[model samples]
Target: MTASLEAKAGIRRHAPAASRHAYVTLVTNDDYARGATALTHSLRHSGTQADIIVLHTPALGEASREALAALGCRLVEADLLPLSDAFNARHARRALHGAAPFTKGRKPDFHTPLDNFVKLRLWQLVEYESCIFVDADAIVLKNIDRLFAYPEFSAAPNVYESLRDFQRLNSGVFVARPALATFAAMQERLDVADAFWPRTDQTFLQTFFPQWHGLPVTFNMLQYVWFTMPDLWDWKSIQVLHFQYEKPWETNHPKSEVLMPLIALWQAFHDGGPIPDIAALPGPSGPAAALSPSAGA
Candidate 1:
């Protein structure tokens, strides 16, 4: 067997053997509060035994902070200082801009998954032995305890392999070890100077850990295909469902109806009277309406 084969086997062997604590981190910016809120409730409802936290930029005002605080999670400010250490001020600012892509426009600012990738490193710094980073747009359908069965590099592959322009991995969900050195080494490869610089975080990661394979597709089901895979609907097969395109609150989402469970959970817990009307969602071409009433108004 080749060295890569030996290493893969070794990593797999260590995956189930390591006993560790698991926590979930949802990284967001101001605009994605609804998705973040829904995710918190979904994870809590599933009785995830791990600590849950939100990582948002410092610009979030007191009212928003207090609101997220009410969810009973430890709110962490993904501030400037640490990022300054990893990247220069200009790059840090660019990274900050990337993290909150929901702001400014319906589309994300950067072409790469840098936001999620950076948050993954940020979560590692916070001291969780093993951490699961879920996008704010995702909801947990079942206890994903077995995800901990894998080691530092685990994720789901993109449905279209040809889309791997630079071999970018999927950013929706992943699990990793807290070993900073391993990640730092990965960052070195992401050296802001690479000629074939990754357009997204996953691409950089794909290059960093060439040996990383993805988890079974069932774990990170893409919402776009609920109709395509209805026959494969073992709800238990899905641990975290990614709301990739049209979020539950977005207008004209062909599949927002599919997120009824999440919408119901949001209504039951949030003091906000009722979820927005599905009819109010933009009809596919228009921009997504904001979750906050002011934005909607």
Candidate 2:
């Protein structure tokens, strides 16, 4: 059977099963493939009993697929949502970036705004009773199996800058219940005439589930918190470390110097090197620390 059909059947066959939760992430290209690898490694390091699933688009390369499979991640090939041509054109990288430029930090060249929509496919994964979707650029620092018990639409508030930012939900890491009904409802509302989502899936999801449950920021800790709100930087408390704007894999990106320590942590996971005790890492310091509170104020 085809993937879509299999997904549908899996939902029917497995939805009623108890404790069938999975950790899901998306991989749109080779760069994110590398990120997903580190993420999966970290999940294993965290000793999670849940299954690891990598939902990848066709853009991901074979070598990257092999790496994820070798690490025991179940690969699910996901297709982009069939939105209108106008919607796709509007959200195309060039047009979207021109209209709403990212000024806070640099986004890597490999970033594609449109590809992010593929994350909606998570709702189609009805086979798993619950799934926690973590962005490929993030690494699990702690076993978050307890998140499966959180309600369907639980997510961390997008609180990198200030307390007010809590109004917005960050899609980087979230708990979801897989059901065909939810997926169908999303499709019906996703692509309307002149419809546009500035932040792609992140925007649509926040709108679709306006009353989304708030997961603690520790569950999806944005890297900016290191510098923007150093007081929130508690290694022991962070369950997931998200590299939001600039990726840790990039060489000499704009924020590279400030993010080096976190990048080093990611490298150790990616390179299969000796994993360091996160609590032992030095707390935030330097000019970056000086720039916060005001920026977030």
List candidate 2 segments past 4 Å from native. 1-19, 286-297
For each candidate, the alpha-carbon lDDT, in order, equals 0.53, 0.85
Q: After superposition, how far is residue 128 of candidate 2 from its true place, in Å?
A: 0.4
**lDDT, model 1, position 104:** 15
Best candidate, TM-score-wise?
2
Q: Which TM-score value belongs to model 2?
A: 0.91
Q: Write the per-residue lDDT of candidate 2 for residues 32-60, one digit (tens) a residue.
A: 99899899889999998888888888788
| Local lDDT at 216 for model 2 | 89
For candidate 1, what is the lDDT? Answer: 0.53
Which residue window of length 10 is worst by lDDT in model 2?
Answer: 9-18
Clashing pairs in 1: 112-199, 112-200, 113-200, 113-201, 251-281, 251-282, 252-282
- lDDT against true structure, model 2: 0.85
